[model samples]
Target: MCLNSLLFFRCLDALVHFKHLTSLIADHNPITENCFLPPLPKLDLLWLNHCKISSLFPWVSKLKESCPNLQHLCLMGNPAAPSYFNGGTFYEYLQYRLFVISQFPSLNHLDDRKVTEDQRAEAQRLYKRPFFERIIKPGSGSFSQLVHSSVTWSGFQNKLTTLLGKDKPNDRNLMI
Candidate 1:
């Protein structure tokens, strides 16, 4: 159902009734991370563009589990998606795409573009294992502790640069 421009400000818990919903367009709403949509096994196209999704971590994982068949997801204007219009650099946008594509390997389309072969390959290379799964290894802290920690962009960038082996002189000092 098209629930666009409804000014929905909280979790859409009511949508769990539509177990067979194949598509849901809820763009232009102020939906936040609290949205607790339940499993929709048939959902393929979900357009939450121009909403207020701010982070990708829990949200991506939740959606991956809830909408396993989802193939097309448009989150263009959301902060989580990261684009030039939202003050994000092209590198950030590419990283966002890589992260999403890596998480949703079955996804065929994202935002306004199709998933390309090169992008998929790069995603695989970047995310050999799920991002969250890497948070705990031997003696590392729990994922919740990491989540509540003060995560700075520079620190994240430094780790990513090290992982990609793209280290440059003083690169760790640069913040996106």
Candidate 2:
């Protein structure tokens, strides 16, 4: 069913009772992560391309639990376009960095193209380190603790540069 262009209506709580919904095209709506509070067990195709979605990490991460049968997803025009995360196009960034295939193992078609087994395997291998560092082996300190740690300003900048692969100017020194 298509529910596109509904400006004010963001929540889908009322649709939770539709247990057998197989396809949902809710594009051009103001939907966010809160819209899918309850799972849509039978949903197979979901088109949520152009909306106010800002971060795919948290939103799409819950797709497996929210829509177990989802095979096709179109998140093309969202603010969290994969290109913004890296210097490549959305598809390339999605394939290498975010590991979209790994995140949604059940997804067969993303933005209309079929996902190949080889591509899935490559994504898993390429993003293994990032996945482990971000999710599995997060830094030991709590948020505040890490923020207030005694590490020098330059040290922090160096670490950030290393992680993000950005260059730091050699002429300037940051003091805390």
Candidate 3:
């Protein structure tokens, strides 16, 4: 099923009805990082490009749990992927790919590239030890807190804009 460019702010709760679904293209939607997705066991491919997803920290785990069989995944154009569109550096993008490949061992493809064995091996080598553990210890006031700590002020404001809706600014103008 394809749901691209629909301006969907959240994961559609209606998708639970498609039991036999194998592929889903949900690019260009404003889906947030914390959106809860229904399980799709048969799902093998998923595209989530150009979304609001930032900080793949816990989000990858959730995707793993929800789509155990997912082989092909695309996260380009999202904050999590760190593409040039968001001023993400090459190093950051490389790290993102390694981290994603580490999380989804069964994944065969990511974004525009096929997951090469060399990349997979490198991902394993880099992420053998949980990366977050080195930065923040246990009981660090939640994973979201860790993610929020690194976000720039502008990024935080952008997240707020997404959450409250862009119409909020117009509403404020009407009060005067």
Winning candidate number (TM-score): 1
- RMSD of candidates 1 onward, in order: 7.2, 7.5, 13.0
Q: Rank the candidates by lDDT, best first.
A: 1, 3, 2
Model 1's C-alpha root-mean-square deviation from the true structure amounts to 7.2
Model 1 clash tally, residue pairs = 0
**TM-scores of the models, in the given order?**
0.73, 0.62, 0.68
Cα displacement (Å) at residue 166, model 3:
40
lDDT of 1 by residue, 1-176 (tens): 66644446466678789898999998887787668879999999999999889988778888888998889989999988778888998878888898888778778999999999899998877765545544345366777787898988887777666644566653322111
How would you encode candidate 2's per-residue C-alpha lDDT over 70-145 as one tens digit per residue?
Answer: 7897876666545553344645455433356666777888875788888778656555454224321266655566
Worst 10 residues of 3 by lDDT: 167-176
How well does candidate 1 match the true structure in TM-score terms? 0.73
Pitting candidate 1 against candidate 2, the one with the higher TM-score is 1
Candidate 2, number of clashes: 0
Evaluated at residue 4, the lDDT of candidate 2 is 41
Residue range 1-176, candidate 3, lDDT tens digits: 56644346577557789867999988888787788878888899999998888878788888888888889999888877886778987777787888889888889999999999999998886675543443455675766786777757776566545444464754321000
When sorted by TM-score, best at the front, the candidate numbers are: 1, 3, 2
Q: What TM-score, to 2 decimals, does candidate 3 have?
A: 0.68
